[model samples]
Target: MTVAEIKVIAKEMGVKTSNMKKVDLIRAIQRAEGNPICFDTHSRENCGQEICMWRRDCN
Candidate 1:
């Protein structure tokens, strides 16, 4: 998703988006949702979260 779209989700979740990069913001959002902070981690290649919404955007 675009940064603008991510920002909207972050705002709704009450996460501070200022000064945070896209990866960081996504990780923060994952944390807020009680999920793992593994948006673009090294383990993405073997990621087990097949149903994760952010999977498509992950590098």
Candidate 2:
């Protein structure tokens, strides 16, 4: 998906739309696609790192 589409969800939840990537966006979509609700609003706190899914590998 495009950054604009990701921005919509982030906008609804008040997350800043800068430096976000497709992998993270796709992951977020997958995480929320079927749940009744998604608490993950793309916050830096929620995402935790630029490479959230792979950060530990670097560490």
Could you list the CA RMSD of all candidates, in the order they appear? 1.0, 10.0
* Cα lDDT of model 1 by residue, 20-45, tens digit: 99999999999999998889887778
The alpha-carbon deviation from the true structure for residue 13 of candidate 2, after best TM-score superposition, in angstroms, is 0.7
TM-score of 2: 0.34
Write down the TM-score for model 1. 0.89
What are the per-model numbers of colliding residue pairs? 0, 0
Q: How much lDDT does candidate 2 score?
A: 0.49
Which residue pairs collide, candidate 2?
none
Query: lDDT of model 2 at residue 43?
Result: 51
Best by the TM-score measure = 1
